[model samples]
Target: MTGERTASGLALEVLQQLWLGGVRDVVLCPGSRSAPFALALDSADRSGDLRLHVRVDERSAGFLALGLSTGSRRPVAVVTTSGTAVGNLLPAVMEAHHTGRRIVVVSADRPERLRGTGANQTTVQAGIFGTFARCHDVTAGVAVDGLSSLVAQACSGAGPTQLNVQLDGDLTPPDPDPLTWWHRPDNRATAQLRQAGDVGVQPSVSVPTDGEPLPLGPRTVVVAGDDAGPAARMLAEAAGWPLVAEPTSGARIGRQALRTGRLLLTTALRDEVERVVVIGHPTLSRPVTGLISDSALEVLSVRGRSGVATDPGRVARVLDVVPRVEAPEDPTWFRRWQAADERLSQLIDSGLAAAQGDSPRASGAPDLSPLAVAAVVGAAVGAHTTLVVGSSNPVRDLDVMATPWPALEHRFVVGNRGLAGIDGMVSTAVGIALGRPRAARTIAYLGDLTFLHDTNGLMVGPSEPRPDLTLVVLNDDGGAIFSTLEQGGRRYADAFERVFATPHGTDLAALCAAHHTAYERVDDLGRLAEALAESPSGARVLEVRVSRADRRAEAAWLRQLAEQAVPGDDPSR
Candidate 1:
């Protein structure tokens, strides 16, 4: 607890702790209050100990950290200056909290002496990211011991953590100290980690798996949501249950996946459901939401996180791990659902095929369909490829149209379903690409609005490290997703066109050119796949313009066709 150490020394120690705590990347937002951190991080970057990312906007830096941590599955640090700079990180912190990503937020602040004096660029920074992150406010009183302990605790596991460091005096590093990996008694790596007995904050909330395997009832099905991983797929296969997985869910690629699940939930089959098994965070569809929330359905979840991980209605049972539901009580349950899904899938295929027609486009330069575009993007995902899909209609499209192929061995499908607001998607994809293997290729599929929302993310400094990324922008002009909703109906068409479907006709090619990033307009599916095949060292934007007029007609027709797939209900079938 020495009182007279240089601020840089303290900053360097913090960085050391972060590095030892498994932080390989650091995102820095330049400002006066956080200058010590900036300098220390810069020095570390020069030494090649860590990769440093500099984003002028603090908000972008936070999300960049989030993406890096999520993609890397390791703690990533973000350093910001005082006042609003720290506050701006709330959105990303909240997202990390919900998504279970370990993003460490390090914010600099003025010392206690300047309290309530209205100092410039100084305000209450501590406890700013409340509830969303574990906040650590380090004063000079316990500066030595607390900082190290807090950093270790933050990096222990899931969820984001914030470190509010209020330093006094001029901030600059002392001469670079020898890298000793901190003061360890035996010079072993044990000092790098906290003791086994250290009872700090638990990384995430969990429910233990102690209950007996519940007896399977009739019409049982597995519902896999975002970040459900591969467990949901395995469970469905092992238990012989039909799996309805979202696009981001790793379970989406398997054979048991039902493409018409979301729409099916809206039909009569939803009424016949006797039991439900839920995994991951299911937030995409209203039918799934209603199913989980329904008191009539016997809902059970073996997912992590005690609260709202599955049953938002708070009635479904939550377990640490899924129970062994080998076979359903009703033998024909799986068969029924499978048959219906197969029939519906066939109908869907035929409808999309009819829409595509048997002719090649010459004047239209390739007709557009959102589902077709997403399918092409998903198909491009191969070995050493990471697919970062945006949270809009693009993700849902892939959920319906993506098939099991194109190097599925190491493929990754990602989306920001935690907040799902479509912010920082481009930057997040870049971070995801950089977080993966150096030779691995990362491609991002987002809407034009999402691309334009965080265009500043493309403003990377020339000297900074870049990601091998391909940004696929599905330009349907505006919010075509709203068109599929009730608002897109004839009654609200007038208002929907103006507000709900707010289309911004921004020239995406010109936008990429302005940023000095490579740009290309892809129409044909093969050309899109070809663009994805190339492993460029830096990021490039690939625009795919879709037709909104045809999109509306096609979606309506598909839904009409899906509604008829409920066997015995429609005589036309």
Candidate 2:
């Protein structure tokens, strides 16, 4: 393990440890202090052990790591220089810490001799992330052997870890394996304390006794958020509650109970339910929060981890019940919730019918509407498929247009809901696809710009096991949805288009060709359906060309429909 013991070699050793400890993706924001680290990362990436994403902005890089971690259920590493660059990661670190997501932050720091002497781009980084991280460690220089153990510990930890490496001068790569350490087994006891769990810590609450039965009625609704998983089904079946599963919950879209509505809103169950059982963490929607907060119902929040309750102050009861695996044995309560959900289903069908109002289908070139494209692709995908929706218009459109599918029972939705940025959309989607089962098809719905933003994510070599996936790019040329934002007014319209929209004239087919991916362009809905039916068993791009100008009119139509559907109480009006 002998060489010129250089700082870059130490950084490389740390990265190698993480890679061997099951970390596959690393996000790097370039800086001079971290040049050696970046070079080592590039070498590792070339060696095929890890995928490195380069982001210019430290803040965006943090969020990109957060998104990748959230999607893959694995710790993602973020690399940056010391000082303000390291500080830029606070927002994402805080969010991940609170949400029980795992991440590792590696910051390049100045040498000790320069500390407290006003060195350029230097700050107190040893314990700078004290509150936000689970553990913090600093290395004087690169230690190949010790870095492996630290990497293992950080990977296994439930929250973020900060590793500050102080570089001396020139850099060199470390030997792959240095020394091995073994631990003696020991039992230790510590004092137990209880508190309202916050981010980065597990809750200590005891589970409620399964003694007396909960009041069973036909008016209960279960609201599930992202990653609710099998628990959503188990809870609904146990309590006889109708499940209102969000797009991101990854639970079955339609099964025993009806699956309709956008995050518990379309059903409008707030008025009917006397009790609401919430599982998983909070959602990104404001309407869901308002409905839950304003409802005159008893809310029982159940979660496996502590500190997951979004509204601890308003919850009638918080149970530390492990969802699905430890759900109650009773079936009486579930029957009532199921009944209420069925009633809501009827209402939704009636509403859709009324909205249609015998209007003949618009005759034209039979071009695909964004809603039509999303619905068709969503329906055609396999039950065990992993659906990754990009930020901006793709996710929102999918949420609105995706129909209730019985085949999507084992499906999961991966999105950048934490910070909702479009920078790493494709890369995160690809990472998520890689984590799932080999048989499962991973379909990513992305906008044109989003597809271009992380185009490097598609650079999977022939030797790599790429996911059996489809990349559906809804290429409307620009940020079509921004036309509806508040800044879309005449006064700021041009500036909004230039700054926020930032449309790129991308040749998507040409981009896919360069990456050696199967590419198809379709404007006709029928052809689009046929393309999806073929189901190519490799990374393929299905580009649906839509008119950006027409999006404005379609949104207007949807607004009118919502107005008529709700009547008298139109928010847009």
**Which candidate achieves the best TM-score against the true structure?**
1
Give TM-scores for every candidate, taking all chains together and pairing residue i with residue i.
Answer: 0.90, 0.70
Report, for every candidate in turn, its global Cα lDDT versus the true structure.
Answer: 0.76, 0.64
lDDT of 2 by residue, 1-573 (tens): 535446765665666566655677788888889877787777667766577877766766776677667656667899998789998787768766665667899989888889999989988887677687865455544355566567777876766888887887864434442221111112220111113112222221223334234556445666666555556655566655567666665554555344434333533334555766676654544545654564366777665332555454484476666333234434544443344444434554454455445533456332456666776666766666677878777776665556555643556676655446666666566656655545356778899887887787677656454656778899887888777666665789669868867777788888888989888888666777777666467788988876565566665565444433443442332
lDDT of 1 by residue, 1-573 (tens): 746455665666777777767787999999987888887777677778788999998778888887787677778999988888888888888888888788899998898779799888778788887788888887655565666678888887578888888778877644455332222223344453445433223322233334346665556778988877777776676667778888787677666777778878777777788788898888788878889888888888765431346678887877667566534454466666677777777887776677677644669654866787777787788766788989878887887677654224767788888878888887788788877765368889999888888898898998788887889999888888888778888899779878988878899888888999999998777788788888876889999987676556766676676678775474322
Task: Extract clashing residue pairs from model 2.
Answer: 239-333, 239-334, 240-334, 240-335, 241-334, 241-337, 242-337
Show the colliding residue pairs in model 1: none
**Model 1 bad stretches (over 4 Å):** 2-4, 174-211, 303-308, 326-331, 358-366, 404-408, 550-552, 569-573
- TM match of model 2 to true structure: 0.70
Model 2 clash tally?
7
